[model samples]
Target chain A: MSEFDLIRKHLTGIGARRDDVVVDLGDDCAVLRVPHGRELAVSIDTLVAGVHFLPDCDAESLGWKSLAVGLSDLAATGAEPAWATLALTLPAADEAWLAAFCRGFAELAAAQDVRLVGGDLTRGPLTISVQVHGFVPAGHALRRAGARPGDLVCVSGALGDAGLALRHLQRGEPLDDYLRRRLERPVPRVELGELLRGLASAAIDLSDGLVADLGHILAASGCAAWVELDRLPLADQVAGVVAGQAAGGADWGLPLASGDDYELCFTLPPEHAAELSVLAAAARCPITRIGEVVPGSGLRLLTSDGHPWAGTVAGYDHFHG
Target chain B: MSEFDLIRKHLTGIGARRDDVVVDLGDDCAVLRVPHGRELAVSIDTLVAGVHFLPDCDAESLGWKSLAVGLSDLAATGAEPAWATLALTLPAADEAWLAAFCRGFAELAAAQDVRLVGGDLTRGPLTISVQVHGFVPAGHALRRAGARPGDLVCVSGALGDAGLALRHLQRGEPLDDYLRRRLERPVPRVELGELLRGLASAAIDLSDGLVADLGHILAASGCAAWVELDRLPLADQVAGVVAGQAAGGADWGLPLASGDDYELCFTLPPEHAAELSVLAAAARCPITRIGEVVPGSGLRLLTSDGHPWAGTVAGYDHFHG
Candidate 1:
């Protein structure tokens, strides 16, 4: 089959069907009708083999992760998933590989009710770029520049599991299935993001770990934050590893600096803190209050006993790391 | 510098700025207020080194062609350009190359009044993916499915010049400056596309040559077309190349079957034929009527003697070719 036929076979008649999409595939451009009183949110992300993923990584997981990460950006803005355009480059036309990849991509797209509106398939080194478009009510989108001095810093679900899984995989060590899944398939907090639309003061998705991702919030909001390392939520396996460390000298690098958590790190006013449990229940995800926004300009880490804690914290940089 | 630092240094404070952009760079997602009654037009294109262009292609021209082809998609749909997101992957962070690329990109963006809203920079084989968003009045966008029998098939500007330039470049032969620029920096006919919105019945951009690209409209419209070979508009250099061929046996392969010529091919009804000159004058692009839509299922080429012509015609396919 031609590349065009391969794309149509694997991509069409799978994702969500929406009325707002005036034109889908098979056109020079896809046409979308943005509902009145709604603003559109757009973001694009690209993943390259041997850089973003292992060269021999599973095609199914790669496809899921590609769309999931782009959706995470929409989640950060509290935008409802609407449509996505994919630009896929492959070394060759492998029918079995394309079928498997499309299955994984379609699964998440169906669950999220997002439609695939357009795509370009070309020949090159394996690279996947997904651009997602979402909708948010006028004047109601969450931003990264609204955090204030006295708000609570919160995160959803556990952290560091994905980082730990990557380390073990790199070392060729066996790991628990949960950790493996965490690294292979991350669930973006779309529901929780929408719930925070009017309540959370500021929001960002945790792709580059808490310290680094939250630093973006601080820089944009012109404020500082302090995170109590003891308050970080950890999975049971991760907690056991932390417990084995020497008392009060444990390294928090995995949770603080490792990437690919795909959770939400947001700030909320003290008065709205009462709604945390409701938001968590609605989203079906755990919510943890890990820290608080402060008055200054840099991130401050506090030890369990309330002493200022300092340790090297850095995030992944694709080019200069 | 860090990857984030490199992106900000090269991307910010450039391109068109508009009030509809609620959030731009440094945000998880760029939010835009789509004007009421306008449908969003979205398309994406990916250019890989050695596949779309030479591996050693000039960075500035690469940048121009990268975005121009995507805008050609918008032009095919009669959409007004608005915002763009760029996802760039490179082997390394070269400042000089990045600056030159940005200059070409910014120049076209400013000329088209398109805003640079978001971007991603990463490390990998050199690849550039540009997703452009535009606006078209509801129900007014041109499509490839409205052609009917008796419609006049038309094209904007001359064909085959870019293909000729590519041929010379691949053979390392001397070429005229005009032909060289045509291959390196072919202009997208965005203005002519918007002008054809209501006047044309079916439209498409000529990226994959006239025969193959026009085949798309035939398949979509469920009709056929007949082209008179003698009426084809050719640049002087291309005409000379054809003239030197043996009489009555000259190959039309370059004009009929080559790619990378970003021109428009549309069909107009007899009622609107009078407006062709007006559109050409307004868009400042030469218009030529070369064929007519007919009630058959496949393309029919006519020789100068008005007899059926038979020849081999095939367009570029990334995977199979």
Candidate 2:
């Protein structure tokens, strides 16, 4: 069958609302009416083969990772996941590959209740470009510019597992099954974002390492942050990796600078920390208080002994080596 | 300078309003709070080098065309253009190319009052992906499914110049100055679409050829259409090309199926035709009634003598040869 036929037969069965979509698949353009009283939050992310993932990566993981990356944006801003459009470039329209991709994509999209509204399938080297849209009430969404000088910084879940997974894959080290799973499927904290709405003074997602990403919030809000390095909640698996490698000086480097965590990093006034703890307990997710925003210009890391610990900044840059 | 530096310097100049954009460009996500009572219209388009444009095509035109292609989607839904995010992939960060692209992008964006909100820059073969967001009053946006059997099919602006321009470049045919300009610069019918909002029963953008693109409306609305071949609005320069290539046949196949016109194709009741004509006159763009929806399936094209005209479908298809 042709690609168009394949799309109609297999991919279009994801149960998107036909009535809400003015134009669905198989059109020059897709027309959708935003429902009344909702503002649209939009984001786009492109994952290239060899750059974003390995050549031997499973199609299911790729589809899951593609949506997870885009959804992480919505999660960071406390926007409810709504619609997604995919632009797929492939070497050829291999039916098996397409089926696996659609299966994985549909599974994740269904879990988040995100509708697969429209997309483009083209001929080229393998690449997945996903644009996700979410809706938030006017003035109710979280932002990076709202943090004040005395706000406490917090992160959802443990950090460094994803970065360590990448390192393990690169070094040809045998990864424990847990670390491998974390790398293949990083969960986006969507529900936690919604719970943090009206609570987080400012927020961002950990796509680039925490320090670099938090530096964005600091720069935008014109405040500095002081992170207690010893207080960081590293994954047990990551700690095991560090212990196995026998690197004793500092294992926090990869977790702090390595990216692709897809977790929420946010801030709240110190007064709200108690309330936030209750909220985190209800959500069943661990919220780590990593630092506090201060009136200054750069991020400072504090050692357990109360001295400043200088570390190298090592986040992913597309154009930089 | 690297692409990241160029974005930090030039592209970031598109100001972000803290009130409107919850999370601005510097963060992992940009949050937009949708105002109450407004629906968000979203669309995405990707233009790849050697596929969407010639490798040596002017960088400025590439920028303009990329935005135009995406904005055309907004026009089809009768949405007011608001903001845009771009994903640019380059083989290398060339300073001159980046400057030209930013100039062209900013020029069109400023003219439309569309904010350059957020985007990603990456390393790869040159590709320009733009996802545009627009707003329309809740439930008031035009759609392709609303066309009734008796609705008149209308199109805004002239057709076939982009395709003819490509042919001229390919065959080394000397293009008149007007035709060259038309090919290089496509004027999207944004204003005309606004005028059509309450008038058009259903609408679509002419990116694919009229027959294929219009077929979308027919299929969705469960109606057939009969178009008069003589009524197609071909540019004067395109007429000259047709005259020169008389051996190609009387049907003017280039205008019939050559894509990239970016005109608005809409359907309206016969009673609204006069008001549409007035609106088109005020906008200084021609509105031509090329076809009428009928009670059946499939599209039929008739010559002045009312006979079927056989022309090949010359519009673009990614999977087809």
Predictions in order: lDDT:
0.89, 0.78
Residue B115 in model 2: shift from native, Å? 1.5
lDDT of 2 at B100: 81
For model 1, how does the per-residue alpha-carbon lDDT over A1-321 read when each residue is reduced to its tens digit? Answer: 776788778877658999998988878999999999999999999999988888888889888888999898899899999898899999999888888887888888989999999889889999999999999999998999999999999999898898888888899999888998888788989999998999999999998889889999999999999999899999987777666665756777778878889999999999998889988999999999999999989889998989888667688778865
Question: Measured against the native two-chain assembly using Cα atoms, what DockQ does each of the candidate structures obtain, in the order listed?
Answer: 0.86, 0.43
lDDT of 2 by residue, A178-291 (tens): 777678788888888888888898898998789878887888789999999878888887766544644545656667878888888999988888887787887678899989
Q: Can you tell me which runs of candidate 2 are displaced by over 4 Å?
A: A1-7, A10-38, A171-175, A243-248, B1-5, B13-24, B33-36, B172-175
Candidate 2 local accuracy as lDDT? Answer: 0.78
Q: Tell me the TM-score of chain B in each candidate.
A: 0.97, 0.94
Q: How close is candidate 1 to the true structure, as a TM-score?
A: 0.97
Model 2 CA lDDT for position B132: 78
Could you give the DockQ of candidate 2? Answer: 0.43
Per-prediction count of colliding residue pairs? 0, 1
* lDDT of candidate 1 over B129-150, digit per residue (tens): 9999999999888898999999
lDDT of 1 at A35: 93
Badly placed stretches (over 4 Å) of model 1 are A243-248
TM-score of chain A of each: 0.97, 0.94
**lDDT value, candidate 1, whole model:** 0.89
